[model samples]
Target: MVFRTLFSVIVVFDIVSKQIIVIRDKLPYLKAIVQYKGELNKDYPDTYTWAKFLELGKSVEDSVVDNIIKEQKPGQCAVLIYTSGTTANPKGVMLSHDNLTWTTKALLDTIGSDKAEEVTKCTISYLPSTHISGMSSLAAG
Candidate 1:
C-alpha cells in the first residue's frame, strides 16, 4: 500500500515507534530511507528535525544547489502525493515537475488571469499534500 511504502520513507523522521517496529518486522527489506539531509553524515547519523532540515538547505552552497537543480531533467518525479483511502488502500500519484507547474497554471486560469496573480499572493497553502487540489494550492501559493 502507498501508506506502508511512504510510511517507511517518512518513519525515519516523523515516526511512531511501535508502528515502525511492526512494519519493519513484517517487511525487512523495505527501506526507502533518508537522503539530502544526510547522505552519509557521521556527525548527525539520524534524521534531522523540520528546523534542522531548513537550516541544512540554507547551509548548502547556492551554486551547488543550482547545479543540482539544473541537472534534473524535465518531467522528473517531483512530488509523490498519496490519495485518501476512503474505501480501500490509498493510491500513489506520481506527479512530475512539469505537472506541478501546469497545476498552478490551471488553478490561475480558472480563477481568471486578471486577478489570478493578485489572489495567489494572498493564497495560503494549508491543505494537506494528500490530494491533487492541495498540491495545486501549494504550487499556486
Candidate 2:
C-alpha cells in the first residue's frame, strides 16, 4: 500500500497479541522467529514483543529523547490513521502534532479546566495508536 511504502521501514508490535495473526499472514518470517526462537527483530524500528521492546528502550540514551523534543515541529506528522474506507479501499491519513494538541486543548477548554482537574482521570487505549479520542483522553489526563 502507499502508506506502507512511504516509510523505509515499519514495525508492528503485538504487545497484547492483537497483531500476531496479521503479522503471521503478511510476514511469516517474523512469526517464525517468534515461534521457533522466541526472538524478535532486534534491529532499530523493527517489531519486538512488549518485554523486549522495553528492554531495548534501556539502550536508548537521554539524548534521543532530548533530540526528539528539540527536532519535533508542530506541523510534523504525529500519527497515521486509516479510514474505514466505506466507499473504497482504506487510506492512510496523517495527523500532525498541532492537530493532536489542538484536539486535547479544545477538549479541556470545553470541559473547563477547574471541573476537569476536580474529576479523576482515566485513559483507555485501543491501539494502532492513531485512535484520536484515546489520544485526547490520555493527553487530557
Candidate 3:
C-alpha cells in the first residue's frame, strides 16, 4: 500500500512538473503569436479576408515556427505592451493568454510566415517578427 501510494504521488508530481514546464515555455509563445495577430488586425483589416487567413494558417506547423503557444494560468502575466517612450511615461499594458493566443492564431492563419527559400522564390522583403508590422510582413513573406 505504501509503495502504491508513493508511486501514485510520483506520477502526479511528474505530471504536474511536465504541465508547468509546458505552460511556462508555451504561454509566452502563444502571447507572441496573439500580439502578432492583434497588430495584423489593427493595421490591415481589409487584407485579411477570411479565406486568405485560413490559407495562411494551414500552411505551416506550430513547431516549424518559433513562438509562444501556451495559455496563461491564474496570476500569470502574458505581456507588457507599453507606449513608446516619447509619450506619457510609458505604461505597460498587461494582456492575458486568451488575448495573445487567439489573436496570433487568427492573424497567422490569415497572413503567413515563410522560409528563406520560399521568400526568395516569392520576392519577399524580410523583416523581424517582433514588431506588429514586421510580423505581418513576415507572415506575408
Look at candidate 2 and give me any clashing residue pairs.
none
lDDT of 1 by residue, 64-106 (tens): 9899889877788776765667888767778887888787789
In model 2, how large is the Cα lDDT of residue 112? Answer: 87
Candidate 3 C-alpha lDDT tens digits along 1-141: 111111111111233333433444333322111111322333321233334445767878886554444443644555444444596665554556555555555655654534433543554445433334344444344
Candidate 1, number of clashes: 0
Candidate 2 to truth, TM: 0.63
Candidate 2 to native Cα RMSD, angstroms: 6.4
**Winner by lDDT:** 1
Error of model 3, residue 37, in angstroms: 25
Off by over 4 Å in 3: 1-71, 74-76, 112-141
lDDT of 2 by residue, 9-116 (tens): 233433523444444445423422121224553432345555555675699999998999899898998876667679999788788989999988887888786776
Cα lDDT of all candidates, in order?
0.60, 0.59, 0.40
Model 1: pairs clashing at backbone N, Cα or C within 3 Å: none
For each candidate, what TM-score against the reference?
0.64, 0.63, 0.30
Rate residue 19 of model 2 by lDDT.
49
Candidate maximizing TM-score: 1
